[model samples]
Target: MDAKLAQIREDREELEHLLSLAQRARVKDMLSINLRKLDTEYIVTKEKLDQAQVAVTLGQASVTNTPVGRQLDANPVIKAYDTTIKTYSWDQSDKFVKVFLTGLGDLSQVSPDQIVQQFTQHSVSIRINQVGDRNLLFNIHHTGQPIDPKQSYVKVKSDMISIYLAKIERGRQWPHLRASDEVTQKPIAPPKIDETADPSAGLMSMMKQMYEEGDDEMKQTIAKAWSEGQSKNSPF
Candidate 1:
């Protein structure tokens, strides 16, 4: 999955370069279409990888018990001890979003391996094992904005657990910490493409829709690429 993602990213860069340099309308549109497809594939692949890793980690956690030589508890009453950590503060800088989980009771003393955390693009789950009488859990199913799972990390502080979420796009401020905190309207879906018709037309329509829905930086990128394609002569 990692190798596939790397290939997709490399192909995207090449296509983007061709799109910027191509003078002919047909060639530019074709490059644009493939670039969009690559972007979609990369996102889907990365998400699957994240989920798979999380599942493996959870499985490992469940199977690990006392050493083989140690005696086991006879008919151990497995009391469900999952305490939801609700008291948290969040702050963001240009590059990272910081989440501080409070009331975890001196996490600095706990072993790093005892803290189980999983990160996805839009969510985070942190489980602090053997914390007092119960396991402390801090979970967000959906964040206010997307984060880079690969670069994000956690730090155990003296009084709390600090989560540093690397922003996918730098300098984009989050409106709220969680998606549920704000009343957000559902995003409009792109118009369905008709395969029977000219494929370039469908590609152009999709590109226009993306430009409309994207952020300021995204809009600038598309506009610049289009402008460059129009002005430059095709090297090929």
Candidate 2:
């Protein structure tokens, strides 16, 4: 999939270059013929890239549908935990709620023991497992209760868990954070246009340029190419 995506990107770059050349050429007819071909290739490659992206996303989702993940999802306490922490917007992949703790500052300075202590104070039971230097994987269970052998644990990132703890410290109730508080929509800016640049010479001008630049033989070839490209039955 990665290789295919790379190839598509490379193809797009090449197509863009060809399109630029076509737009600049003085012979309109010849340039138009090749421009259509380039456009078709660009569109097809773009569609393939989009399909590949969707397939990759679906593949990731399928991994989370395994037997263990299903069992964890079905657990009553885990469901409640999910409902309670939905405001944090942690990544719920696999049976564990994987949180990327790298967003928080200084993992080295943050003591895992201190974090576990804080959660205990808040009546949340969790087992902290540090993965490498940055990520802290949490296995959440009912406070002070031993994890059942049959029950799968819920996971959370240390950073989000810290935020949850902060809310508790402020005397906020369980599920205290509202959905609106967790999400804010940013307005998207319109694409910038360079006003000083030549207003695109347009397709007709490009075709004229192609015709003007080409020799007699080139002009004949371009005319044929254009006719073949424009044919309704042609499979270009």
TM-score of each: 0.46, 0.22
Candidate 1 residue runs with Cα over 4 Å from true position:
1-80, 184-236
Writing each residue's lDDT as its tens digit, candidate 1 over 1-236 gives: 78767766665554556444444333334444555565556556766886687666555555667552122233332333557687889999999999998866766668888789889887687878776566777777556778999999989878878999999989999888765455344433433555444434555665676567655655666687777766775665
Highest-scoring model, lDDT: 1
- Tell me the lDDT of model 1 at 17: 63
187 in model 2: Cα distance from truth in Å? 46
- Candidate 2 regions with alpha-carbon error over 4 angstroms: 1-26, 65-236
Q: Could you give me the TM-score of model 1 versus the true structure? A: 0.46
Query: lDDT for model 2, on a 0 to 1 scale?
Result: 0.36
In TM-score terms, candidate 2 sits at 0.22
- How does candidate 1 score on lDDT? 0.67
Write one digit per residue (lDDT tens) for candidate 2, span 66-138: 8765664464221001111222343332232223333433344445453332243212333333323222323
